[model samples]
Target: MADTKTLAEIEQRIAILRDNLRELVEQAAGFSGAANEELTADRINEQQAELDELLKKRDAMTKS
Candidate 1:
């Protein structure tokens, strides 16, 4: 079970992750190399996974 403080912290992290993904996509759009695109895609995937996990955790916490 998570306390209110923990839930708030999770929410904050989720927001930050979303901002990071948006910025990464914008930067990727400007880059022209295949290697840069691949690297950016990998980073986006990792961040997306993290955001998904946090979203799940937040849902579970709220349901409890």
Candidate 2:
């Protein structure tokens, strides 16, 4: 019950992060300047790292 709920929440967060990553990529493509590009790239890396961690957690939970 609780585990299921938590898993659902995590899944929801993962989906949102994926969407954010997509938008970030698009924004990076449209934007110019080294500073702006670096900022966007940093954000993308953060989101991707978070997404990867969440995926690993979800996988472990499912396996359990």
Candidate 3:
């Protein structure tokens, strides 16, 4: 139902998604004491799921 995303839009989305994913990775790696032991396996799964879904959406947009 939505129109296709422009190349710039797709790229911007990818960059944003990548940044979010990088932050998650940093948290998972225990970058700060506040994040240490706070990101459990379940939390990681949820974060990864969100990223995965976004990637799928991005892929579909590019395919179209």
Candidate 4:
């Protein structure tokens, strides 16, 4: 079973990831060029994957 501290840490990480994802989305939306747009899109995808993983981990911890 996970301790309270561990759960809190996971929740904090999730919050950070959510913030990062928001920032990435905003940046992607603000872009008007072509060269850097691909890079920004890739980064958004990566952040989304990371956020999804963290959410899964948090769910698992809570279920235990």
Which candidate number has the best lDDT? 1
Q: Predictions ranked by lDDT, top down?
A: 1, 2, 4, 3
lDDT measured at residue 49 in model 3 versus the true structure, 0 to 100: 77
Q: Cα deviation of 4 in candidate 4 (Å)?
A: 1.7
The digit string of per-residue lDDT tens for model 3 on 1-64 reads 3355565575676677677767767766765565454654456567567667767776776677
| Higher-ranked by lDDT: 1 or 3 | 1
Q: Residue-wise lDDT of candidate 1 within 11-52, one digit each (tens)?
A: 999999999999999999999999999999999999999999
Better of 1 and 3 by TM-score: 1
TM-score to native of every candidate shown = 0.95, 0.96, 0.47, 0.85
Model 2 clash pairs are none
List residue ranges in candidate 3 displaced over 4 A: 1-39
- The segments of candidate 4 whose C-alpha lies over 4 angstroms from its true place after superposition are none
Model 1 Cα displacement at 33 (Å)? 0.8
The alpha-carbon RMSD values of the candidates against the true structure, listed in the order shown, are: 1.1, 1.5, 4.2, 1.2
lDDT for each residue of candidate 4 in 1-64, tens digit (9 for 90 to 100): 8688988987898888889888888888889788779888888888789889878888888889
Question: Over 4 Å off in model 1, which ranges?
Answer: none
Measured by TM-score, how close is model 4 to the native structure?
0.85
Model 4, residue 24: what's the lDDT? 82
